[model samples]
Target: MKILWIDDEIDLLKPFIYLLQQEGYEVETATSGEDGVELARREVFDLIFLDEIMPGVDGLEVLRKIKNENSQQIVVMVTKSEEEDLMKKAYGSWVDDYITKPFSFNQLLSVLNRTLKRRSIISEQMAEEYATQFRTFSEPADYLEWVDYYKSIVSWDLRLLDYGSNDLKVLQKEKKHEANAGFAKYIENNYRDFLNGKGPTLSNNLFAYAVLPVLKEGPVHFVLFDSMRLDQYYKLSNSLREFFEINTEFYYSILPTATPYSRNSLFSGLLPLEILQKFPQYWSFEEKGQNRFEKELFAELLKKHNLRIKYSYYKLSSIQDIERSINSIVNDKADIVITVINFFDLLLHSIPGRGDMKGVLDDERVLLNLLGYWFPLSPIFEIFKRLSKKQRRIILTTDHGFIRVRKPTIIYGGRSISPNLRYKYGPALRVDNKTALLLNNPGDISLPYEDPSVRFAIAKEDYYFIYPTKPTEYEKEFKFTFQHGGISMEEMILPYAIMNPR
Candidate 1:
């Protein structure tokens, strides 16, 4: 492979060039941007490392000219500046990859492998690394171990998507499925103990554990993206990292991981049954009013903690709503501001008609691609930029996450049962015990219901509950759609983080 190293200080790169030459790669050097662009135009090279700063024409200009001439030319920017604006400029010029200055020869070779030999070399490396990491995998022994295991799986899931083979993707998906099965079994056995205060920080206490300590430091801007998965948070963090220094940790959502139950628990700092019993007037399970009282519940939480500080709340479903509310949220004289963005939840619910839903069922990477396409163009990008300037402390989290349902488990329930596909609650609920957790007493898990005979059945793994009637037809309709309120790592293990503006 031929590589062109374009740097104003070309002599300093001779060691790297020599290392590449020793590895049987042709190395060419250009001392100026004009010379580099001319060299790139004259001969086709496998990779071009263009320095960011040059004497006559800067890196951005050279990048534009080279790209204008041959749009397919692979240009990797070598830069010393870590400024956001400079990186954005390079990206705007369509640079393929980047390497910061003061990097070693191995780092340059890694970038070369990533840019030129990504499919063949990097994929093999990732597969070997993943195999080595999980060769002796065992079911997590406790909640803390489960958190670590889940994080490693999420990390591999993202890494494999970037630099692993198709066979490796399949293998990782199988491993994730196995992990989910074990996670569901763990929850089935110890969930009640968790409710009784024996496990990690849960939904009802997440706000206290994640926010109050930060509140002691300063005012907080709490942003909640409803129904966001851990992997989605990891994707969003790249954008968030530019504005804030983030510290992320994982917590567990309560049983029936839906907005009404888990989100209310988050704000009110009380279990669902406790919410229903203590604040019946504010609690509602109706679709439109499910989380209508979040502000009230949050206020109740603050008061329960004996705090009389000012606070503001905004719940936005559309981009226009968020755009309009930003000024008010930023300007409000509140010690804490809470904004709940429901667009992600709306996106998940609206994607059943999309052609890629079936692909999502077969390969989870499809959903990641969908998120990747949407996030860059999403309004949250602008919102984050706006808030980052004024807000010093930020708390980011979600109520729960959705899992793409691959298997439709037959469940028997009446029309009065809640229509969520992942969990059902009503009188005389019957489902395959292997696929779901059947709770005759909802109070066992602190889940609320009006009637004494009301039972809850939460689907596990990739299973979604379907009524016995018209089972086949319903299965086709809801098969690959994302749903929550179930027992899976995606839904239960959630991302909680604190961010300080940089």
Candidate 2:
């Protein structure tokens, strides 16, 4: 790739240029910012390394000019001043990276290489690496250990995604789809055992294992944001690392990874049916009103566990609520604080409602882009930092993750059937028997029974449920909308992280 280096001390940087050239990079030099801008305009260099201090048209001015000309150009600020205020000013001008003066040639080369080679290196290297191991672990018969393999593949996929390598991303996606197909077969065979408590930790066992121990340590703050996919979790988890050492673990969300059930089960520490039976008052199957509180099941869980500490539960549905929650936490010292932010979940559901969002988050890559823009600046993160300052232990997790629905499956159900693209809850619902995890007895899975004949069915993989009455219409409407409550790694695998103030 071509790199343009602009510096008044360009002659002194001969060693750096030679090292980069030896590394196979096209090194172009300009003695002044004006010359650098001319070269940039004349040629399409991949990146520009501009010195902050220059005789005429200083780095900041040059940066402003470059951005005005082509905002997409990648520019790194090289500065002799290590002053915090100057660094901040350079960053504020939108430079990709800042390099201090007197830096080693190796460090300079490393930064340049990372910036230019991130995509190519990750794409080619990761694809080749995963391809070899893919064969060794592709067997469907080895279901017992598939979870780890699946997680490994997902971890790589997320890594490549972060690396922003489109080619490797596509390759990893295809591989992951292949793994998911095999995983579907495995789940079909073993799901019954898992739900029946004859196997590993499924949805029912997630909270008991993940949350209870943390609670015992001190106070446990569980933030169960809905529809937080694993990749998004990876992005947000990076921020938490500053204050919390993450002991990351995953659990399989029950078939329907949707909020009403999956999130309820997570907070209540009981399956859907058990929640209804245990807390009928809080459990509402009503079509209208905030079905979220379904019951004050969370409060009951703490009570049942005999874990008594001052705790607060806040649901942030609006920007105002988020600000308020952050403001409140800044002053108070609650033992535990559980805040559920619905922005991601709302974003998913709203994708179908709003044409713009649907167009933006059309795929996983786009979805991650959207997430990267929002999560770090999110009110939850702001509150987290404030809480960290108070030296409080924190646990940030999600109810379930989301998947971009591609294939649509038509199902015939009565008018009484609940209309959810990822899952269906009604009697006389007709679906492909093999494609869904059908819960004939909701009671067994601890899900509430809406009717005496009510049953729950969740779509698997990238599939979403559509009614036969308006098959084509619904298919067109919900094709690319993000939905949950199905069986896929994105939906089922949940993230649990514990953090203590650094």
lDDT for residue 165 in candidate 2, whole number 0-100: 57
Which candidate gets the maximum TM-score versus the true structure?
A: 1
Question: Candidate 1: worst 10 consecutive residues by lDDT?
Answer: 343-352
The lDDT leader among the candidates is 1
Among all windows of ten consecutive residues in candidate 2, which has the lowest summed lDDT?
345-354
Structure candidate 1, residue pairs in collision: none
Tally clashes: model 2.
14
Prediction-by-prediction clash tally: 0, 14
Q: What C-alpha lDDT, on a 0 to 100 scale, does residue 433 get in candidate 1? A: 94
Please state the error at residue 325 of candidate 2 in Å: 2.1
lDDT per residue, candidate 1, 13-131, as tens digits? 88888888999999899999878876765565778999998888999988886675444567899999889998898999889889998998889888888888644665677778888
lDDT of 2 by residue, 1-502 (tens): 8889999899999988898889888989999887887676545677899999899788998886665444446788998788989878887877877788889987897777676665465457766776687666646464346657766876786666434356766777787777766777777777767777766666556667876777677765667676677767776675466566777776777766777777777777777777777777767787555246723776787788786777777777876777766777565556667777786855444343566665566656556545544554567668877778877777777777877788888777677888778888898777886667777787765667767788778788888888777789989988877787788777776666777778
Q: What is the lDDT of candidate 2?
A: 0.72
In model 1, how large is the Cα lDDT of residue 307? 89
- What are the TM-scores, per candidate, against the unseen true structure? 0.79, 0.75
